[model samples]
Target: MLLKRIQPMAYHARRLYVELMFQVMGRALQAVSEVDETVRREARALPAGLLFEMMVMPDGPRLVVEHTGDGHFLYHGSQAPRAVDLSIQFKHIAHAFLVLSFREKTAVAFANDRMLVDGEISQAVRMTRVLNRLESFILPKLVAQRAVKEYPKELRLPEKLLSAARIYLRIVTHLFQTARTS
Candidate 1:
């Protein structure tokens, strides 16, 4: 297997991923830091009154990002927007913030033991929404994808399960989102 060629099987799950997640978060932190005075000024130009405080916690079998924000971070962030905290254990990076925007399915899965989540629930959800519109979309476009490709492709999944899971997740998530508004 490609994964085997690169590293031993011991480097497969949790241990391997903890390292990877930190790396991903590192880039995210850098993205936050690197935003220039002008660029951030524009990004912060959402509304004079809308700013937020976001905290993400990936603490579980699958990644669990917990968010805590009042939806106002910069200008009138004094009273806090509306505190939202939620937790979810999502296995794929692709589905990260997208799920948080519209559905609680992932949160349910985590609570039912099929997934995992820790800490506050509302914040988890808030963090994810911010990421969906902010880090997830903007960072990739601003930076090259090559930097985060160190993980071997095969380790991305167990070959037999990858195709089915990815396709199924995409379809289900798409349909769910589509159904949400209508």
Candidate 2:
């Protein structure tokens, strides 16, 4: 009985953590698109007005991104808009938490059947590249090594530090601005 009770509490905690991670990631993507040339190029490759979503199955936390006409991305928060062009859905919250926490890389999670992609393979590949680049910029080198297939060789330590600082600052500022408006 005690084990059952504890399990539910632990699961809820993990869910909340994953939800927060999604929020940060959504904002980080938006921030990177605005400030990173590589990300802007990637966004340009995607179809304008593309709506991409990442969520856990069965009504879990989600992040939606829209590719704008000017080669940028807009974070749409957790509420998915109608007609998502591509969707990556984790089979469960545990799978999402594993990938979000860097305990499991995205390719590994997909290979392990922890995720389902519901969109064009080519578009998904492009989005995956964008996410990998974003992770490289935002994560520590050590953690990024585990999260990405290959750490970007050209990203010098100084540049990485500066980019991370800018992205994080933007995320915080955007959050504050959103809160004020709300």
Candidate of highest TM-score: 2
Instruction: Pull out the clashing pairs in model 2.
Output: none
lDDT of each: 0.35, 0.91
Residues 1-182 of candidate 2: C-alpha lDDT, one tens digit per residue: 89999999989999999999999999998999888898888779888999999999978999999998566888999885688999999999999999999999999999999999899988898899889999999988899999988889999999998999999998988899999999
lDDT, candidate 1, at 50: 27
Best by lDDT: 2
- The 10 consecutive residues of candidate 2 with the worst lDDT sum are 65-74
Q: Mind sharing the TM-score for model 1?
A: 0.30
* Candidate 1 C-alpha lDDT tens digits along 10-118: 4344344544443344233223323323224433424333223322234322222211122223211112344422334455432333233223334443454444444
In angstroms, give how far residue 181 of model 1 lies from its true place. 50
Q: Point out where model 1 deviates above 4 Å.
A: 1-14, 33-114, 138-182
